[model samples]
Target chain A: MSELRTRMSAAIGTAPVEATRRGAERLAELRRRAETDYPPMGEMRDLARAIRLHTLANLHRYLSEFCESAQRAGTRVHLAADAAEANSIVESILRAAGARTVVKSKSMLTEEIGLNHALDGFRVTETDLGEFIVQIAGDRPSHIIAPVMHRTRQEIGRLFADVLGVAYTDDPPQLNDIARSHLRRRFLEADAGITGANFAVASTGSVVLVTNEGNGRMCTSLPPVHIALVGIERLVPSPAELAVLLEVLARSATGQRLSVYTTVVTGPRRPDEEDGPVETHVVLVDNGRSRVLASEDAEILACIRCGACLNVCPVYREVGGHAYGGVYPGPVGAVLQPALGVGSADLPFASSLCGACREACPVRIDIPRLLVGLRHRLVDRSSFSWLGLGLEAYSRVASNPTAWRLFLSLGSFGLRTAARDGWIGRLPFHASAWTAHRDLPGPGAPPFRVWWRNRNR
Target chain B: MSRLSEFLARIGTARLPSARPEVRAPQLDATDLVSLFIRRLEEVDGVVHRTDPVEVVAGLARRLGTDRYLSWDPDRLPVPGLVAELETLGIERHTGPGREEVPLGVTGADAGLAESGTVVLIAGPGRPRHPSLLPEVHVALLRVDLLHRSLTHWMLEHPQALSEGSGLIMITGPSRTADIEQQLNLGVHGPREVHVVLVGA
Candidate 1:
């Protein structure tokens, strides 16, 4: 346990205040531009929620419609029930295209599935600047929205100098241009471009991508064969519904009036076009979400992956996204990780249940409620072994007044005995994870419950 | 593969097995409706205009530097005099031609959606799809009334009008990118500037 803590601490060195502060400043300035340029936040949130809900409700129908329509438009539609299958389908398509090198944008789902590692035969480059930085650093993203949010500018400058064979500077503009010149060639040369879908319209057989970077357009259009790995829940019924989602997605993600590039592609480029991709493939990945969709947890599908919930979260603000140790982090990640059946129970417990995430979410997903629900699932199924079973027992006792009182009195005596040398330090092994950070306050001379009982007597 | 197939079959055959009870729809108001449309259009980086048709043309000319306007017909324009005025301002005039020869293209918007400030345009004989995308400066003549309250409203009215089998570009603004260290570079692959001329009540 100590080793794990040490590993995490070592992995996440203190964010260089000056560099991180500058990054945050840039993000804030960009956010301001987005807010000024995009529509009102409150209105966008409402529409986003509506469109998400409507899509979730009719997901299967829309997915079927989208598949049928895309097939008619000369694009192949493959359904992947899980991440492994999704990756395999893409690998097969790329192999068929004889793709030696591939260019990609930052996709959380692909990260969740560890797709880059799975591409054994091909060289894949994540073209998004933050992703590229993280890729070169040989580190995982700590934040969902900004993968390298923990890195200082000086660190990035060092990374670029080492990896790209260029002199390093902490200047943001210079770094940007360097990355642009580096990636521009990949955008033109790559045989296949892979992307994650923002929204897939079943009505029009179209995939809508909202990107501040134009890489998404080039990645989709420049290559001969284009592959989109989309989660099943990403489907909307029509183009009209897609419009509603676009309203909220930009503001929620970056506070933009609208993203600079919103591309709606139905199929491959027509024969007349000089530059569009010749083939388009949409891979709908279920991964474990269909079970979530089938269960009472279907609302989890309404997530737009805007990462707003992370921004407002107190825990995430302190620990950062990398601490969660998954592709997702914060409130949405807490609920989603388990539903996607990706990782263990530790992620669901990584929250304070303060409800700020629910408030911050544009779709107003009751994340706390969902967390509690997941906790119930975790506790009930005894899926978490001894720790979960202990919690289940505690919950049963806590629900009853007499049992709770009796248990507290006994526990209080143990706490009083455990306190020595005017301090209660070094908890038993199970509780060590908490005590490692701060000392627990000693129990009072007499339990409050004992005094209450005496007073009543 | 077999294991995956079995899993997918289970997902496909699985009924709605959720224990969650149905929730009554929340009361959504007009402001909620308008903001929803506006946010979506804006996220796609569209510009909204509230001026009259005559004023919008002036805005267009001013934005594009009163250059030569290459378009289909002068009579179809809301302000007939503005065409000659643009020509006088040294804006070149021409009908739809091959995209290679067309540097600046002007065409009519099918409808103006107020929700996101999006003006819909469909490619036809007079309007080449290439100019809507390929030109250095692409301008659309939009109408005010076509502004939709919501995407739902648009769908309810037009149904599947947006589904283009070959090409469908629902453009919100000038093509832009943040790929280079998240710095915005406008006119990367598409038009550098998108000028909108609102032409109606």
Candidate 2:
């Protein structure tokens, strides 16, 4: 592992406890906000759902319209069926532009595809404050929204002072100034810039970048060539629809009026302009998103990249972003990563089915329902053994109440015999991982159905 | 060959039929509309000012240090005499003169939509889309009467707006990003500063 990755992993290993506390506190705060201040999140979530549903149902029409409009606006758009293709196309563009050093804005798609790692042959710099911190440290982002949420200010001060040859200070202003100074030179020196798109307007061929800092502007404009990596589903039919999404995104994510800056870039700079990038190319990455889109559980695409779900998820709140073992984390990641990565059964089991994620979603994605659908997909997999066998056996006994009762009664007798005090200390096989964390409750002596039948009689 | 065509194929493959959806749409009001637009800008450390459009430009000019600027429109000032008053400060107007040479860029607004706190600029005849983006400073003139509470409202108001093949920029604030080491930097690529001058009749 690279020094950064190792440090990140070590730091991540220690984060579960701290993250557990912070995540719990954040969840409580959010719940309190939901109850007292923003009581209408559930309602707003529904409206977001309706808007996304309308867009997705007729995605073809909207996407084509967006492309036509974007093309007319003078943007060259490339679609990649997966991450590799997306990276390849982007790399090719960078090479053609004669770019050696690239300054980038925070883009999860780039993280997912390991774009920076692929650019190891060249110099690639991350400009988003959170992304930049993690980039210099050579660590993967720990949080979807706040990549350096795992690190304390002291740790960051050390990292910057050590790596960038700047004075070390835990103070935010001092830190901010140092970062600004370091990046200013890169912005001027870079030959190309890369960013992730918040939304792409099919009707106007405009890419909307919502940010707090102004780095995205530099990354897009400072270089001669600008490239954007956007998910395929990030398209809204018109700027009007795009505007609605921008409104809800900030409020739900950070409770702000708007991000510090919102820039709508259409194609490249015109001949008369002095500063903006001369070339603009947008890479629309499918990267298994298209596969999920085709599935009956396609609502996952409606995600606006808001991290609200992670803040509220009981499991995510406990383990943090690193434990999810992917670029995305939390309820959204539990569903998205497996769908986007590989059709693996182990990934979907990451959720606890608490439905807190769905409750917090601005776009009102029924994450629990999708998670259940993923379980079915996993079960259908040819490699699925234990779950498939268990469910298949369950169907036979479940058909008859009498048979089910007998089977449960017999199983209860055996479990009780095996029980130590009130709990089963450990299981011999697949169930062992569960007991590692918490004890499993022993089955009661008398079966509930039998006791209820006797009492009623 | 086109990204759109490839995107279409991906979309075609991902389309699945829905059985039933349990969620319902929520009722929206005007306050929700206002809050939504204001909220996105505020989170990223942006400021929102509500004032007469004429005062808006003057206020922004004061913040930017000088009244001298180059604008796309000939009749940009809310009152015809306002530009003449500022003209002593070298507030030169440009039809398509070299925009790169100007420190401040002033352009007429196409529409000021309230949905995203965005002032839309439609680059029509004589204006190249690039000038609006490349300047160190950009000052947009947004008409207050043109402000709509919702993006849908704005779209309905201008049905052929996006299809006009003109450059339409929905600028919320100065160009910015937090990508490098997550530190916020201003004036990186596009304009270092963006001030919207809201003009009212």
Tell me, by DockQ, which candidate is best: 2
Runs in model 1 lying further than 4 Å from the true structure: A2-13, A16-58, A380-457, B1-8, B12-157, B170-201
Number of the top TM-score candidate: 2
lDDT of 1 by residue, A1-457 (tens): 4432443354443553223334444554555566555444566566567667666665656667788777777778887766788899999999998998998877877987789999978989887777888888888876666677667667788889998999979776577767766886787678999988888888678877766545676677667888888887888776656666766676667665446556667787765554567888988888787778777666777898887777767666655665565678767888887877765565666678998888767788989888888888777786458876788999999999999988988888777777776567878977877788887887876667667879998
lDDT for position B106 in model 2: 61
DockQ of 2: 0.23
Cα-based TM-score, every candidate: 0.73, 0.75
TM-score (0 to 1) for chain B of model 1: 0.62
Clashes of 1: 28
